[model samples]
Structures are given as structure tokens and as C-alpha cells.
Target: MNKLIAIMNRVLSLFCISLSSILVACVIWQVFSRYVLNSPSTSTDEIARFLFIWVGLMGAAYTLGQKRHLAIDLLAMKLENQPGKQAALKLIINLISAVFTTVIMVYGGGALMLKTLATGQISPALGIEMGIIYAAIPLSGCFMSIYLLKDLLDNLTDISSSGTSTL
Candidate 1:
């Protein structure tokens, strides 16, 4: 399990890094083409915009795995028990997030992903298939949901082993 998680972490990390690099490179090229060449590449703006979404979603998943996402702690800190309930409350919050995202994955993203099998949607610039790009939404959601589940399980295990009330 640990090895699988580690491998997932590495793959997600690489995926995000590559997407980010592409976005950055596209933006840089866009700027160069407009200012230096006196004639911009028409696809530069469209490609960059599309790649930005991919990078943002992929990077969010990476942050989820790295446990680097910003979390509002106002409620968790105000709770009664510090160590015990804090973890439990956090798990509940994560569970809620997972459930919400799962719904979006099913309803909103599912149409975009599963039903667009014959999609011919193309990008304005590169004429790239938009369906392929939009596929990242559900894909990221699945990965993010997995991270939440993993976090919840870890907290549950900790509580169970320690006989804590929070779990």
C-alpha cells in the first residue's frame, strides 16, 4: 500500500510538473511571438489558456498528495479536544469534500468525460481536441478523492490504535 501510494505520488508529481512546464513555455512563447515577431502565433493564446486549466487541476492534485493545500483551521482549532477531536473533525471535513467532489465527478464531469466519446471539439489555436483536455477534470477529481480517502483511513487507524474518541 505504501509503495503504491509512493508511486502515485511520483506519477502525479511528474504529471503536474510537465503540465506546468508546458503552460509556462506556452505563455513565454506567446509573449515572444507578439512582441518580438511583430506577428503573434494565433494558437499561442488558446493553447496557453487550455494548458493553464490542465496545469491548475493537475497541480491541485499534486498539492493534495504533498499535503500542501491551504486549509482553513478556524473551526478545527475552536473545538474542545485538541489532538483527538481535531483529527476527527478534519477527517469529517475531508470526507465531506470527497463526497462533494465525487458528485461533481459523476454529474458535471461525467458528461464531459464519458459521454464525449465521439467529441470533435477542437482548440482555437493548435486545433487540439478539447475533449482530451477536458478529460483532466474527472481524472483530477478521482485522484483528489483518493487522497482524501487515504487521509481519512490514516486518521481512522491512528484513532483506533490509540483508543481516541475523535476517530
Candidate 2:
């Protein structure tokens, strides 16, 4: 499982880097075309925007997988000496994160993606189905949920092994 997660993280990192490069190149092209050529490229703006969205979402998932997402951690720090409390707090946090990511992002994003697909709407400049662009939402959500589940399992294992009394 850890190996799978590591591979996924690496893939996501590469994906984000590629998207970032694409976005930068597109923006540069757009600027050069508008200022130097005196004609703005119609497709570059839209393409860059879509790439930016994907990079942002994927980068967030990658960060979460790395366990680098922001957290107060004041309570956690305070509870450091209390193994059971620390484990319980970690479990609760992971549970909440998993539910939010799964319900709001994963399930909701999936429904939205399907509806957009059925509507057959296409981007004006790119001429691609809008649903394809929106797919980043659910894909990132799944990645985040996977990380949350792994964290939850680790916390549970810690609780079991600590042999400390329950909170």
C-alpha cells in the first residue's frame, strides 16, 4: 500500500510539473502574440486556464498525500505525551477530512461531471467537452480520500499498539 501511494504521489508530482510548464508556456505565448504580433491567440487563454485548474487541484492532492497540508496542531502538540488522546484526535481529524472530501468533492464532483457530459457543452476556444476539464475535481478528491484513509489506518494501528487506556 505504501509503495502504491508513493508511486501515485510521484505520478501526481510529474503531472503537476507538466501542467505548470504547459500553463507557463501558454501564458507566455498569449502575451507574445498579443503584444508582439498585435493579435491575441484565442485558444491559449482558455487552455492556460484549464491547465491552471488541473495543476492547482492535483497539486493540492499531492500536498495532502505528503501530509504537508496546513493544520493548527496546537492540541496535537499539547497531547503529545498522551498516546491515546493523540491517536484519538488524529482519528477524528482524518475521519472528518475523509467524509468532507468524499461527499462534497468526490460524489458531488462526479455527479456534476456526468451532468456536464450529458449536456455536451464544449469550450468555446478549445472545442473540447467541458466535462473533461471538470474531471480534476473528482480525481483530486479520490487522491485526498486515499491519503486520509491511510492516515486513519495508521492512527488506528498506533492506538492499538500503544496499549494505553481509551480517552
lDDT scores for all predictions? 0.78, 0.92
Q: How displaced is residue 6 in candidate 1, in Å?
A: 0.9
What is the clash count for each candidate, in the order shown?
Answer: 1, 0
Local distance difference test, candidate 2: 0.92
Clashing pairs in 1: 43-125
TM-scores of all models? 0.88, 0.94
Deviation of model 2 at 37, angstroms: 1.5
lDDT by residue (tens digit), candidate 2, 1-167:
79879998999999999999999999999999999999999999999999999999999999999988788999989998898888988888899999999998899998898899999999999899999999999999999999888898898898888876366
Runs in model 1 lying further than 4 Å from the true structure: 116-119
Q: In model 2, how large is the Cα lDDT of residue 29?
A: 100
lDDT, candidate 1, residue 16?
75
Question: Model 1 over residues 17-124: C-alpha lDDT tens digits?
Answer: 887788888889989989999888778788778778888887887798788999877887687556677777877888888887688863577678656646676776
Which has the greatest lDDT? 2
